[model samples]
Target: MENKVVKVIIGILVVSVVFGTLFFWFTPVKDGKKQLDQIKMNNNYLILLIQVINRVLKLAILTTMKDLKIKLNQLKFQIVLN
Candidate 1:
């Protein structure tokens, strides 16, 4: 039950991050040197944001995997004892 909740939360987070990244990546920039320059600056910030989001995603996946591994090990121990 708890695991299902965690999975749902992670799924939502992943979908949101993917959609947000795609939205930023495909957003149109107005035509002009000044506008282009401004977009380039904003792109840098967006890139940083993307990197942070990717890191968060990686951390969440790793944590979830670790938790599953621990739970599996605990279950194995219980079975052995029983």
Candidate 2:
């Protein structure tokens, strides 16, 4: 269902972000200063990307929760009838 699909998408995004952060932080590099400078230069872009991803994650979770609530209510109503 749509709820399952949304949950899967959220899981995938969360996993990717975790691995990406680990790789970004722990991966070996040749020049520390140069790497630092590069990261500093791209900081704004990184912040923007993180913000966009955060918004997407929030929206996905909210919709999934809403769908789940609707499904739960339907089930409850069915049980009451039975």
Candidate 3:
């Protein structure tokens, strides 16, 4: 039962990530740039924000992958134990 819940959660997370990446990547570039520019006048701050955003994106992807791996491992264990 727990394994099934994990699978469902992982499935939802994967779908969310796919849709999120697509949404963010294909979003109008001009608006993004404009907002980034408005947030900070200094180049350094803009660079920092960009870096943070990139890191966050990477971390999110990594986290989702890790969750999936754990769920798969649990299922494998259950299969072996059965």
lDDT of 3 by residue, 8-78 (tens): 65566657556755654455545777757644444454465557556655666777788899989999999
User: Can you rank all candidates by lDDT, best first?
Assistant: 2, 1, 3
Query: Over all chains combined, what TM-score does candidate 2 have?
Result: 0.55
Which residue pairs come into collision in candidate 1?
none
In order, candidate lDDTs are 0.73, 0.74, 0.63
Q: On residues 1-82, what C-alpha lDDT tens digit does candidate 2 reach at each position?
A: 6667767766776777677666666666689897897577456545755886787778877887898898899999999999
The predicted structure with the larger lDDT, 1 or 2, is 2
Tens digit of lDDT per residue, candidate 1, span 1-82? Answer: 5557656766776676677667665677677886677667667866766776676667767777889999899999999999
**Residue 54 of model 3, lDDT score:** 67
- Clashes by residue pair, model 2: none
- The C-alpha stretches of model 3 lying farther than 4 A from their native spots are 1-42
Root-mean-square deviation of every model: 4.1, 4.1, 9.4
How many steric clashes between backbone atoms does each model show? 0, 0, 0
Error of 3 at 66 (Å): 1.3
